[model samples]
Target: MHFLQHLPHFIGLERLDASEIRLTQSVITTLCGLPALRELCLYMPSALARSEGRPFPNVHRLELLDGFPFPTTHDIVAFCNKFPNLRALASSAGYGGLLRDLTRAEESSIFPVLQEYTGTLRNLHIFARRSTLTHITLVDGFLFSRLVAELQGVAALPNITFLSLALITSESSWFDGAQIETLFTLFPNLTELQLTFMPTEPDPQILTWQINGSLDALLSLLPSTLRSISLKLDLSDYHDTRDPDLEDDFSLLFDYPHFPSLRAELMAKCPALTYILFDGYHFLFLWWKTSTSSVWEATADYYADARGPSGAT
Candidate 1:
């Protein structure tokens, strides 16, 4: 950590990637002294919950790769308050309950920490993963609702342009078309979006399933400014059921046979969209725009040529 003392002299250092190292008070303090440091990635230490350190006024981007101490909301609020100019933040959802608190209808006091970056904050990445079914049920919907509420509460972030949310859970209803629409409404300027939903079966009652809606109806709700989009939906559970009507609906809505047509439809509707990706059960569809073409060209000459042709299995 002593080497960090010399970092201030390298005044030109604008980005620091310390994801592989454990951060300590001494190390963090040393790095914060760097006058030109604008971007930093490191783990937040439990000690930070008690430390009264100087603010990183110049940092515009900060990524916390690990969970903070217990009561993560307080720690996250402290860090957000410390970095007044942060434009981008990436962290695990387990460590940032501040989002949930902000959306609470009973908490009337404004969050000064988040208010500090309202004008400059533009990107947010939140990732949540839980292997146990009990734990998943305890936090998945609650966290997601809080996220939505937080976004609804913050009306000052008009410049926000990128958002990514990845979750591993057993709840299929955690995010639906309505929720996606709500997200678009919250961040109207978003140009890029990525969503990965990995569903696990914890009990017979809880299985991954698709939301009821046509792809066109969902895609139409996206902002016109969107230039890139990546979506992964786990629909493998749809085939496990014995009901014929349910299977028919699932096959008609999201089966691989309809992807090429969906691709063409999406490109025509969203002229600014240059990239689209869909990865799921028996489906790996990708499309990108090329020069001299207003339409999206499929990655493979034919969908079947890309991989051995197969139906929803």
Candidate 2:
């Protein structure tokens, strides 16, 4: 009476119906013996059944969870040796360790064998302990930059049309203009870009002058092949005025110049920019006349009836 031998008695009866059956090695041995099982998954090591010199040949889509004790890369390599046709692998481990465990000899080895992978590689998610690190380490630390390099390193496959970067505003210095330029260069076919970041209230006067400049710089970094862009900035910080730098930040967030520059830049370079969502406001209809660009048009048209000083409106 071994532990795995008693599994089938505890199997599905009138009371037991669950799609995802999570079990350890002892339980799996019993579950696999059930001919009624359709799609089986082993969260434990693939080698568990093999240790007994038996194989569960029916389980089509296998997922290896993080419960295995394989510390080195070879353990993963040995595991994948059994499940040769595994289609997708999803893991929360570091990319460097994952890649080593994956046992991919080269770029082709990975894409061809795995076919479609949805997780970051082992080395892509590394971070520096301290604030002061060199450019190479900084570049390595950012996942998107590493992704760009990996995509470039790999041989031809289907073109990647869109790339989304999960950005932290605190990490903005890591993604300077040079890094952005390198990204566009690496992924020439990329047309859509999504950037998510925590917001900072730019200086009203400074933003009045620099917003468009920054927009222009960003636009210039992108390739001509790009047609659409979606940029998101988290404004939760914009509402907070406690910091010394952001003492008067609320004023900057609502400042007239900020919107004007944003409007002008959107009108100019992103002409094909079919869509734009700013803050929480959705600009569904944008009517920019080609006859003459008037900055005061919105001010006059909207505030014409208001009782205020002539210049106030």
Candidate 3:
């Protein structure tokens, strides 16, 4: 990492792909010295000390490969304080503690980092491992509601244009139709969104979500600014046993018979949406903007080419 010092003109630095490289305070200080550094990616280990009183004035993008052991809210606050101009922030959860920290934060003491970028930050992404949610208590719907509340707090992100969150576990609660609507309300200016949901147990009764309305109600909740969206649903854990004959059957794995109608409704309700990707039952439904007659046609063709006639393996 010392070589970075010689390249003072460097505008971007990414060492996340290097799993062996552990970032420490001194290395961070070295990177901060770069006069033009605008982006940085690093793998931060737990308990790593942070430098004080130095801000990355030019940096607008920051990505942390591993969730830093933010020992306290002050640590996260201090880190955000250092990147005053940050426009995008991405973090991976080493455990579920990060989510707990964000959700449990008192309303009076919201995430200071997000508050810092309330006007400038345009993109936010959080990916958590399944083990992270294991410690949380699963009640009627407390855990899911808490998670949603944490996201809702981000309504302060009035200028945010993109958001992605992938936190899946067998015990995690599903986001029913109402929760989905609340999500769009929280990020009203979002131009793109991506989400993944997966449950752990094999209880057929518990795995499937019971949305109150048709898919149109869910799709209509999207903000007018949204141009693209991706939803990945993993229901493999719902089955008690795997049948060899149906192992390769995609349609039998998950049920969404109204998918075609949903696509049509989406096009009608959200004309700005140029693309939609829905993957369920191990089947993929993709749509892209083109000169084609219908967006659904494009999605069907893409699905057919990718999955073949059976559409599942």
Candidate 4:
């Protein structure tokens, strides 16, 4: 028992995954014994502040796992202080639900040097105004009004090179695809992109999205620096429903008759785009070249994939 308690002091522990450990004061004291520790993963790390100890100076990468509620404003400050040199923050669970109460100074200082973040769009919107982040992945999906309205005083971040996010398909908002174009403009240097779609309502009798116009107006604005694009539909909410595949329709947008020509034209205009993928509905599109010119091609995975999208279920 004693050896187990003093185990950290004997070895040169450089990385730790304490996410499953019930972190206690003794556990924290054990952490202080490792000076070479540079990477860490923790779960619901609110107790770090209460344990009086010198901070880890070299820790730069932090991965926060979700089991309990997120650290509150009370613990957020001191918890972040433990890793003053942190540069990347990742969380599988959505982030920044209760952290909206932080003061301007605290918000600015939180992840002050962060260059990469993977979490919810809500938190990104909360911190984007003050962040210089170069890579972002928002799993919770984009909320347009919530992102732009709060950034009235902030300029678009050009340093970002990679971005992946999900957007809910709401006919009223996403019909023209203007929102996505605006998003591309925010990160001018973005090289790789992936966009997933989700239904706005959880279990509607029949879910449908009929874009009123062609998506070309938005595709025309694809960043010249962008090299790849991916679009997906998440039907996880319909796993147990009756006729799930046929009921949740997104036809007018994805199965537009002219999309093949549109893609060829768009790729010609952008020149830098090497791949355009439609991952949802089992559809796939590729960019290839002919003897004299370049063109776009479509590949399918199954019989359903080859069929055109349905306007409505």
Best by lDDT: 4
Q: All candidates' lDDT scores?
A: 0.53, 0.41, 0.50, 0.65
Ranking by lDDT: 4, 1, 3, 2
Error of 1 at 186 (Å): 4.1
Q: lDDT tens digits, residues 1-313, model 4?
A: 4544775875577778877676677767767667777788988677676668777677888888886654556666777777777778888765455666677777776777777888866577555654467888876765566556645555677888888877666645552456666676677778888777675653332232332142455566678777777766676666547445543344322442245676676677667777676655434444544445455465565436664432221
Question: After TM-score superposition, what is the CA distance of residue 127 in candidate 3 from its true location, in Å?
Answer: 16
Candidate order, TM-score descending = 4, 3, 1, 2
For all candidates, the clash counts are 0, 5, 4, 0
Model 1, stretches more than 4 Å misplaced?
18-29, 67-76, 96-160, 166-190, 197-212, 235-254, 290-313
lDDT of 4 at 71: 52
As a TM-score, model 1 comes out at: 0.60
Please, what is the TM-score per model? 0.60, 0.49, 0.61, 0.76
lDDT tens digits, residues 206-267, model 1?
33234224254466787777788887655455555644354444334533436667766766
- Which candidate would rank higher by lDDT, 1 or 4? 4
lDDT of 4: 0.65
* Total residue pair clashes for candidate 2: 5
The better candidate by TM-score, 1 or 2, is: 1
Q: Where is model 2 more than 4 Å wrong at Cα?
A: 1-21, 24-69, 79-90, 95-117, 121-158, 168-176, 198-212, 224-228, 234-313
Clashing residue pairs, backbone N/CA/C < 3 A, model 4: none
